[model samples]
Target: MRRFLYAENGAVSVYLILIIVPIFLFQAVLIDFARIKAAEKESESAVQAASRSVMSSFDSDLQKRGLYGMVLSQENSEQLFSEVFAKNLSSGVTANAFHFIDTKAVDGGMRVTPVYALASHAIFEGQLLEDMKLKGPIEFSLEIADKFQKSGVKAPFQMGSQFAKNAAEVEKLIEQREDALDEAWHSTEVMYARITTFHLYYQKRISDLDAMANRIGLHTIDELRIEINQVKDQLQSLSNAIHNMDLSMSSMMTASPQSIQAALSARSNLEQQYSTLSQKLNDLEALVQLIIQYTALIVSTKLEVAVNERDILQLQQSIEPVLRLAKQKNDDIRAKLTAIGGSSTSTTSDSQGVNDVFQHVSLIGDNYFYDYQISVASIASLFTAFHLKIESIALYTAANTNQANAANDAYWTLVNDFYSKKSSIEKARMDANDGTKAKKQTERNKIQAVLDKAKQAIGGCSFIQSQSNDEALYNKLQGDTSNLESANVQGFYQKYRQVNAQDVLIGNDVAYDLDKAESTSLRAMDILGVITQASEMLRDELYVNEYALTKFNYRTYGLEKDRSGQAKLSNELVDPGSHQLANQEAEYLLYGFSSCAANISSAYAEMFSLRLAIRTVENLLDPEKELLNVGSPLLVLLVAAAQGAVEAFADMNALVKGESVELSSKLSAAILKLTYKDYLRLFLMLHSDNTKLMARMQALIELETGKDLTQAAAYIQTNATSEIRLWFIPQMMKLFNGSDLLGCKVVGTQCQFNRTAIVAY
Candidate 1:
């Protein structure tokens, strides 16, 4: 055995068994490893090719607008994948090594387990940029984007929009003020009517008192006393009626309720003084009766008492105009009586008796006339009080009337200005397009509503009944005391109306979450690795707005003839049963108006506001208008607003007619022409909330597509994933001779090479 171990006997055979066997085994393992690598490569290629083939079946509707998205179904995607996979494997050497691979894909060990998907705003940005590049040079596209960004400045337009809202509110407030003033003026007129009756009643009382004084000589002391008593009773009744009055006001009064109460108090005090005068008049009547008896006694005794007939006449005349003359006449009559008594120098008892009677008569006459004079003065004072009260009311009413007239004038001026601006707008509309009378009437009705609101605000005034006599007015006032109170004329005129920007009503009520969280997709990039990851995409806001303008339909699109008679663009399949905005999709997207009419109006309003802002800025820049640094800022702003409104209306008309308008109305300046579509793009870019934009876009897409985007196979996916099984590698390994470690288990029976493709645009 030792000799055999060392000897050359069968040495070649043993050496070959040791070295050649190991070497050949090593070569077999190497060959199996190479085969496994080839299978892995071939399977990966097949999956990548299948994915490309599936992507090729893009949605045709999206493609028409230069957008890209796969119109995928599970069965279709699977079949497409299986066919392409089979073709890729069959064309290679791996197909011959693994006969099962050449069979149907399902029969083979290949399987698709999970399909991950991605679709977002970020995904479509790349394709849009590419398509934009093909349409124009990159520099030119960038310039357009930059031009839109710079020219469509939102600050000025936003300020103008707020100003428009403020102006509307102010206009309404002015109308309200005018209405209040009207009510106030009417109330004042009513009060004036009532007070005039009081004034006439007092004047009649004075005339009656004067006539009674003039007839004093023709009547006995008793007759004069009866006339005075009758006049006093009439005055007492008038005072009582006025004192019981319960007048009040519904609105603010120039004279406060307290002032009215004070006037009534003064009348009541005067009535009290007049009541006291009745006692004095009774005393004077008794004294006059005594004087008549004493005068008869003196005459019978032949002791004549000196009395001035002229003094009596003077007393009657004085009663009509002056109360002081009554006292002077009484003093003269007493002096004459005293002289008669002094001049009687008889020492006899009969003469002394006559003198005593004369003295008694003179004293009675003096007291009677003095008391009578006081009575007349009291009536005159009451008359004066009534006169003063009437005068005060007249003054109040006159001031209010003046203010009411002024308010009426101002309101008419405002109306005239509004009409002028409206005419300018009408001219613009006519210049743009002459619609049917019905259409024009419809537009006019909308504008008419605003004017009607203002007109209605002024409202109606209270009707006052005119009276021919004081008695009739007194009777009416006795029944109703409301007109006696003043109204809130000063408050209405003095109150300042304020304008708020946030309170502006655009009338949009579209439901959307602006603060919703969102996930961004990268690109349609096929990355083959252990950890599959998506790429990044462009996220420029201006580009997104540009995309929206190109893809969506506007309100006026129905009028265009090139769209196959369809009223709107059908970007996706819409459910026939649902009630959605079909024609005004673009307008709804921008202004969120539900009806086509509202949408159109809103669009016009928006364009009008923007143009108004631009024009206002121009007005401020214009030194010739002289609207800056003035006492009445509101007036200046109103003037600017008027001009802006006119120009804005014209601009909108031009835009609706598909005519280009200059960004600035300055003809001498550089021309920056903007079409209707360009304006829409600018409006869209004004939306800053990404989530809101996305949600609105998704809502519109779902409405058109008739699909629930949250569900499977409902939305366009940018990313897809598949697991490729290594059937060829496992089968190829079985053909090579190897130990248990060298079997297909070394690389696993099936290889899971995750290949994911993400679409970014």
Candidate 2:
């Protein structure tokens, strides 16, 4: 060996052998170390994967068991852990030696220690094993162990306790009451509005009726003044004539020298007086005849307030009570409810972003309860005013002179009376035809024909003359009378019947003069013949007089009933059918008015109560602002519930918007648009805690990449250490204001990474 070491030529060979052997041994060590290191790395990766896989299942397990009822058995846990650990094993590695060395529980999770047995590869078995340990057949055994930790964060929920149970019941009650309130309030308001509108209409109609009646009254006054003036003029003229006549008569009584002189003066005065008296007499008789004829044409009609007072009164009676009931209910609710919680500021700046999907913004305006209250009040006031207006309308009687009281036959009665006279004439003619004759004139068929026609032409002139002869009755006649008989009773039936003044009955253009001998009588006959024409003139004047009494025998179409159950003449004043206030609308107004007050009162009470109760429930949901941050099951459920509610809001918004796409009415669109979140937010506000709710929160924290995700992510760098980018831990911490996740212990804000090393010699 010394010679070899010194010899250069042989030394080279020996040096080569020595260097190669050592080099080979070093190579073996390096190869075995590489293989072992590779295996160790694989094992570590597998452990990490198993841990995460198991931890991620926490939620699923909690779901299956129920959030409140968590029964995590150790046996079941071990089975899960084993199954996961085996699934993550590297190829060629068996778990025959794999066993649980220890198990422990940690905050938010479970800790498991599992040891793994593995075989060395043939590449590192033979010489590498001998060098490390003297082993035959190279039955080299290796065991790898690691401490795996799995965790799950849990939220607290109190679904069955006093706070939850009672609050839930109260919440249900509040919902029911709110629904009732909405119905009642809206109903009452509708009634109030209808009644008010109808009452306004009623007022206008009644005003028109009043005006019409007042016009009639004015016309009657004018007519009465005209009659009084005519009578007064006649009286003045008569008095003057009588005074002058008396003076002349006195002068004639005393005959002397002074008497002779007085007689001459009296004679002149007597001539003037005679002429004046004659003129006055003619004028007075004509005036009296005219008055009597005017009386015959007069008629009296009853006028009254023609309102649907029965229907109107029903509304009037109903409104006050309903309003009172509504007010009472409001008061009662206010009394029952205590103080509610105040609102808290929100952290979210883009809260309205949630509403972008919806088309309508209903909760902001008239759709809200506060506005509904205003609506109710406004309608109530209008109805009250209308009710008063109805009450203020006067129910009175007025004279409608145009309406007839009895058989208002102007010409028919005359014709009938003429027929009666014809019967007597027929008998007279028969007597004259057989053998008799008038005292001087001969009665013939041609004369009879003329008499019959003249009789018709004369009409009721004789009767009219008799009525005209009633001088006192003529002076007493009013503007319009119900009966002509009563008006001219003193003068009626006092005329000379069967007068021989044929000239008076004959036509003015007649060729023959029947009474040329009686010129004075002939003049009277001419005047009497003119009576029919005058009577016709009077009847025509009165017929068109709007205020003149007319035959009101027919029922007034739609006027109010009088005390005698007769329809008043106001039907002419206003159209009853056109005014539809007294129909169904009127009845509904009554029902609503009657019930509105009570309904609204009850609604108000319940609404107020519900408001207070909602506030209380909100308080219970979060007693303090901090409760929202607490890592309890209850809080988790609350967030879950909120999340669900928000999601539902989005869904509802989508649904309504979709349905209302073709709608024309913007108001309907607004009304139909709604979201549960709007109400839910309100519900949350009344919370005593006054904490702002965080939206879309999750609970999970990942401690490693392989265990947290499907694969380990690594960034390429130059001469840089591998940076352990912990992506899951942060993600979990951000899930909520909590530090635990997947039943894993979060030590001082992080999950504790449990690692273990196994050694066997």
Candidate 3:
């Protein structure tokens, strides 16, 4: 040994051997350490590969709907894990002197822990969006949503409930107003009848007074006057003879003195007598003629006075009742207006005018006859006063009747307008033509015209104000009824008539297991959380909705069709044509309704509600309606509903017919332009209940595929634990100073790996 130690050449070899031995050992240990690490990596790789392989075996039914899901039992998962793991591990084998170069997967080593999630969640995460890779549909949906958001359109969910209530109240108020109006008309007619009766009574009294005046002819007075004239003539002749006889007596007295003296005495006496007799006869004739004339005048004047007095009394009585009736009618109309929540202040003024006329007529009692004093000279004045009163009464009667007729005409016109609108609405409802673009435009114009006409008519009514409950409510009824008559409305209902919603959406409730891992799909995302950034959520939701549109069948389109011009089949399943749904998976997903018709119709109505709300706000803000801005909030709501429903109906009809339509007719923007899918996309984004949506989607999936989607295993992430044997763990531990460097738990001669991998597609 000493000699060898002294030998330089041999000693160099020994030294080299000594130095290389530990280094080689260290190298070997290092290699073993690396292999253990490689095994850990290989194990992770195996699990990841297995998870993906399992995911690749997606449910064929879900895939047919463009949804990717996997349904794997634990046994099936373990089997798949082992197969893929072993295959991946067994590839590219290499051998070393220190240990086996390739890893060997342990049988039954992997514990498959699948994290189940609903296909909807996975889809929401943009799986189907990525799969379809269609940019146009998603862009279209986003554009539509952005347009509506910018346009300030919102879903009228709450408005719908309130509007329904308001609509009912409005209908009730309208009926009440109609009843009040009828009562008013009846009262006016009664007043008119009373005025006619009073006028007739006054006319009869005037005719009788005229006849009495004419009949008071002076026949007896004329006969008496003739007799007096004859007596006066005889007296005049006797006075002339007395004068002549006196002259002759004077001549005879000159011829015979004694006879003349006696004749003179006699003549003197005779002259005295003759003069007295002549004066007496003249006085008698004058007195008799004057008495006869005075008697006739007094008799005619008294008769005229009596007749005029009676006529004035009758006229006063007749006019008083008519005026009273008029006053009552005016007061009643005012009261009715007040009861209907109208501004009766104007009617108050009208009542005051009526009261003035009534008071004037009432004060015109038999005081006219008393003022004339029943005298002969006053008879003419009395007759004149009575005639003037008669003329005034006749004028009042004519005026009252004319006014009542005018009022009745106004009420009748309003009622007729309401009925005409109603009739128009009925006709529109009965219309069977399809709503084309031109037709829809025409319908929109008609709606606008109706609204305009209603506004004008309501505005023109004097007795009823715009915000009055009765007038506003009538406007609402007319406007809404007319709007409902649009061609779009007809088209919308016509679509439902062929395929009713109640008939198809029969699965009101679906029953399934609650405890299964797949049952977690029943739990939807927290909508409140998702909507924190509505714009972002909406964009993402649009993608998912677009995916449904592209992949599934709705009322208008089919599901995936094969190259052979037939419905594509996955997993030997027939097309949805044989099912009751008949290709309504997309509709079910959109509206969560089992029926295609229900889905479409609900969406349609929702669109109408939304449009109504938007239109209502628009109308409320309109400058033209500003004059009626007060107390018309309810009216605004109703008007918007009417106009919005009509426009929305037309839009939906046009959309379903594959035409683009604006979201709001009032808004003119390229963004507002939307198509059928765009509308469906909006509905999907607006759908707040994700759980129900998922459930419905799952229901339809189950219905078509006969597989419970809740039971369907869709992998979101996987937790895989596998145990592998490693002979160098102890050595690795010692080398690394008892440190588990691989970040794995080490048992005797073995390593445990719990690998969690996200395996969702």
C-alpha lDDT (0 to 100) for residue 688 of candidate 3: 42
lDDT of each: 0.41, 0.29, 0.46
Tell me the spans in candidate 3 whose CA falls farther than 4 Å from its real position: 1-31, 90-102, 119-136, 146-537, 553-580, 583-601, 608-677, 685-687, 716-738, 742-758
How well is each residue in 1-761 modelled by candidate 2, as lDDT tens digits?
99875767876787789889887765654443344344444445545554444444443321221111112344454456455544544422443453221122122222343221011112111212332232221111010000000010000111112223322333233334433443444454445444444445544444445444443433343465565576567556656766776676675664667866765676566567656655655665555554444333221111111233334345434544444444444443333222110111221222112111111111122233344444444444443443343334333123321111111122123323433453464355335323211311232232333323333422221312123322232222111133555643311011111111112111112122221222211121232122112212322122111111110111112333445766444322223232212111111111111122221222222222222222222323333333322312223223223322223223323322211111111111122221221211111222211000000000000110002111111110011001111223334333432433322233333322233322211
lDDT of 3 at 722: 52
Best by TM-score: 1
lDDT (0-100) at residue 279 of candidate 3?
A: 70
Per-residue CA lDDT of candidate 3, range 709-744, in tens?
A: 545566546555554455543645544534667655
Cα error of candidate 3 at position 614, Å: 7.2
Regarding lDDT, does 1 or 2 come out ahead?
Answer: 1
lDDT of 1 by residue, 94-125 (tens): 65464433322323433333232212434444
Deviation in Å, model 3, residue 435 alpha carbon: 37
Can you tell me which runs of candidate 2 are displaced by over 4 Å? 1-10, 56-71, 91-110, 113-680, 688-761
Predicted model with the maximum lDDT: 3
lDDT of 1: 0.41
